[model samples]
Target: MLTTNDLMTIDPETVTADVPLREVVAVMNRANIRQVLVVDGKKLVGIVTDRDVRLAVNSPLTTEEPLQRLELLNGFKAKDCMTSNPRCVTPETPIHKVAELLSMYKFGALPVVKDDALVGIITVTDLLNQMALIPEPKS
Candidate 1:
């Protein structure tokens, strides 16, 4: 059975929980990724998605001034907007199970962990890439 280890992105982009949201946006832009794993050392702690950053910076009730928006972004840290203790899968977890969890939870990715330490991350794009490599069976 294909597992996360077979298709996961090793050393995926990560950020410390104390990282400022502005920096998170920069990382995402530089990496061209939709989400980033929040970690403390090697341990998985949370996740912050692009949507989270967008919402944080573009709240309708908040001021429209760019200066205020900048302040808001700088004031918020990853921990403030991140989903704490996000569900995770081990590297040995089957890809189908990961797919199921992603579908059920509507998650873009799931952190891959081993021995309580972050190892990698498996995203919807990862599964799709693997699927593309599979050969078609006889009709």
Candidate 2:
């Protein structure tokens, strides 16, 4: 069975809490990734995704409010938009388990950790790729 280490993307792009929302978007665009890990020193604190950005910008409360309101009210930093205490998996975790977690939680990705250190990330795309390599069982 494949493990997370076999399919995870190591040293994935990360953003600090203080990084501006605009810059986080830029990094996501440049990296061609939907999510980014938010870190403080070596600790994995949170995760920011494109969906989070969209939700923050298009939230009903902000509909009539000026864009500047985000800066004042939301702090305009990765920490503000990021989801803290994100669900994580370890490198030794089975790929099928990761798939089950993602499916059950509707998550696009999960951070892979070992010894409480961020090591890599596994995404739906990775699972799909792995699935493609597996032969179907006889009915």
Candidate 3:
């Protein structure tokens, strides 16, 4: 059976709570990833996704209000945008169970923790790819 250890991404990009929201996104874009783990000294504090970044901008940007948009962006921080202390999974967790937790919580990914330290991350995409790797059953 496939486990989280088999599919989880090791050493995912992580940010601190005090990091500026804009910088967090830069890391996301640089990594071509949609989510980042918020950490404090190797400990998992929260999970931040592209959705969180979108949700941080509560108002629509307008050509007529460029300063206002910039002000809004500057006011946001990772701590303000991140979902703190989200549910996490372990390396031993089954991929199917990870899927269930993600579906139930509407989470984009689950932080993988071990010995109270941030280890890896399991995203829905990982689960889908794992499923795709399964060979077809004999007829």
Candidate 4:
């Protein structure tokens, strides 16, 4: 069974709830990733994604100058924009089940936990990579 353990990224990028959104964006950009796990010492607390940042920054109700926009972003913390208590999966969870959850929830990634500690993360890209590796069976 191709479980999350087979493809989950170990020790994935994480941030505390108090971290600024600006720093969160920097981390995502630096890692070339779309999602980041929000943790409190090893416990998964929330999740921040590229989409979350976009929604927070591009709010239709707010139209601020560039400098003001920057300031607003700096003031925003991970907790202000993160999805709290996000759904998670265990390392032993089947990849297909993970895929289903991701599709159903429109989630970009799912945190992998064991013994209530953050261990890794699995994303849509990870599943796609695994799919590309499977060989086609001959008819």
Candidate 2 residues lying further than 4 Å off, grouped into runs, are: 63-75, 135-139
Please give, for residues 1-139, the per-residue lDDT of candidate 1 as tens digits: 8999999999999999999999998999999999999999999999999988888889997888999999998999999999999999999999899999999999999999999999999999999998998899989
Per residue, candidate 4 scores C-alpha lDDT tens digits across 10-56 of: 99999999999999999999999999899999999999999999998
For candidate 3, write residues 10-87 as lDDT tens digits.
Answer: 999999999888888889999999999999999999988899887766545434465765665678888988999989
- lDDT per residue (tens digit) for residues 80-116 in model 2: 8899979999999998899999999999999988888
**Candidate 1: regions farther than 4 A off:** 136-139
Best-to-worst order by TM-score is: 4, 1, 3, 2
Instruction: Return the TM-score for candidate 3, rounded to 2 decimals.
Output: 0.89
RMSD (CA, Å), each prediction? 1.5, 2.9, 2.2, 1.3
Misplaced by over 4 Å in model 3 are: 60-67, 137-139
lDDT of every predicted structure (CA atoms): 0.94, 0.88, 0.88, 0.94
For residue 138, give model 1's deviation from the true position in Å. Answer: 6.6
What lDDT, from 0 to 1, does candidate 1 have? 0.94
